[model samples]
Target: MPDFDFTALRRFPDVEADNLFAYDASDHLILDEAADDLHAAAPGEVVVIGDRYGALTLGALALHDAADIRTHQDSYTGELALQNNAAATGVTGFRSLDLGEELLTGSRVVLMQMPKSLSELDEVAETIARFADPSVTVFAGGRLKHMSIAMNEVLGRHFGDVRASLGRQKSRVIRARDPRPSAESAWPQRAYLDELGLWVVAHGAAFAGPKLDLGTRELLRHLDEMNPDARTAVDLGCGTGLLATALARTRPELAVLATDTSAAAVASTRATAEANEVAITVRRDDGLSQQPDACADLVLLNPPFHTGSTVHAGVALRLFEEAARVLKPGGELWTVYNSHLTYRPALYRIVGGTRQVSRTPKFTVTVSTAR
Candidate 1:
């Protein structure tokens, strides 16, 4: 294997900060553990899933001369970052694909960055078992702090043998072999939310998965109160498309759009809209960047406070800025957030004058009219 420098990678087109990173110890650990298999595997036999940037894909190509690599990244931001980093490093030989048979259908070795959600892991594991060759070996890695015994159990369900590696650099890898294919897929789960009178659909990685989160529930309570004259609305960071579907169902006259950064979220939202039989435009976007400035009359947001496993306010603030950009004068931005975030001042400064619509002990709902 050739020496490859992982530090050359960057998280372009994604939020970058001193604390956030594109590559981590887990990426290196996964690659190192799968080194022999990656070198011996034939072209197109190696698949990478949950590659945050291009570390796994590019590292394989750079170090092992791996070719025709198929990769799947759930986050559009991560996908773009991988592309950008590949271009920057001039490391190429991989194709970004959606999570399915196309990405998993193969033989031999698989490198994966274990997701925080067990459901997501289950979906990926089941897909691998169902599609990949029975002889395939999967090396799934993550930071030790984020990993748990349950992850081994998740992998154990689909693999006859699942074992863990000794921790290295605060990271660990779980190796699984002897595929036990299942006939069923456990993803894109669905449930009916009685409170909203809507069916919520969610993929494994979708936030809050097929359930009405308390924050979104709080925001939905004011749906009828938002700008009665509004004709156009956007559900910024739409997870399961609850807000957009609800809006379209209640006011068929209103043109509603649902946008999210995660591929899973977009898929879930579209499924939710289809299940609810509501007309909604669902797009996988970075906030409302694709929307025209001053185009929306009202925007609903339940912005996330964390980026990945790291708790940070930058993600929410960026979404607020996007909401401000897409909202027209006199437009309203309704946001539901944890009370501890204290986003009122920032909302007032970024969007316009903000007013508290309702507040629970743990959550706060506010409406800011665009300036």
Candidate 2:
């Protein structure tokens, strides 16, 4: 085993802008705190989930001689970053997978970066407990600021015993043991939205979790004014397929495509679309990378404001660029964003002919036409 260098890691295609960082204190603390436990696990028995870059997976490989570790990263960019880091460092034998039986089966030790959402944590704990080896031990770490007693409660729902570590560097790790295999999973959860009369389905890692985000809610109000006669529409960065489903239901003649970078988001969108009885083509893609150029006449976007925990605009800007490329000449790109982010200028520059469709206290809705 060799000493690993954390500074060499990068978060390309994720967020590398100023005022935001690639890795965090929790990433290092998780590996360091679980060093002894990880060392004791067999080479092939370690699993990592939510590793932001390659910190946990690569660290285990380089420092503990843990080989063939199975990992699941919800974000496509995070997975790519892990691959790039592994290639750069010459580490091998780690497998990247979606959260499922294949990723967890027979694993004895699981390392996790605690998710910000309690539903996400619930899904991870349930899947790990139900699919992994009965004796598997889980170490979930996160910054103390984000950590909550609710996380432990979620873990307790799936595992028999849960314990916490003393905070170090404002980060802490929660350990859960004694899996409860029969626990009912709360993931791929289905909830009915009374306001829209729509059923939204979401996997744990999906953003907003089957609920209408305020921005998307604001955008939905203006969907009727969009190019209704357009043949093709896209829900770019469609988290939970709320926009796509709304569009499909409102305009049944339109062919809608829902694309997201997160595997979980893609799955959730697909589920949401199906649950709502709406037809949509859903794909796990980096922005609109899988869509042909100028193929869409209308594109709907509710771009995310954060990369991990940092409020960064890189993702929103990238999505805007991709939406511009995906929309045909004279097509329209409808967007809703935080009012303070002031995405109007970027929309005008990237998509052209920007106009404010609606604005509320928290969000601003804009329509940009493709020149």
Best by lDDT: 1
Best by TM-score: 1
| Tens digit of per-residue lDDT, candidate 1, span 66-126 | 8999999998888888999988988889998889988888758999999989999998899
Model 2 Cα lDDT, one tens digit per residue, 1-371? 57777888877767676676657788878888778888888867999999988888988888877888999998888888899988888888799887999999889999999987887888888899999998888989999988899999999988999999989899999999999976466679889999999988888888888788898899899888997668999998888898899899999989999888888889989888888888899988767767789999999988888877777788899999998998999999999888888789989999999999888789999999998
Query: Which ten-residue region of model 1 has the weakest summed lDDT?
Result: 1-10
Q: Which stretches of model 2 miss by more than 4 angstroms?
A: none
| Ten residues in sequence with the least summed lDDT for candidate 2 | 13-22
Residue 101 lDDT (model 1) = 89
Report RMSD (Å) for each prediction in the order shown.
Answer: 1.2, 1.7
At residue 130, give the lDDT of candidate 1.
Answer: 92
Pairs that clash in candidate 2 = none
Candidate 1 structure lDDT? 0.91
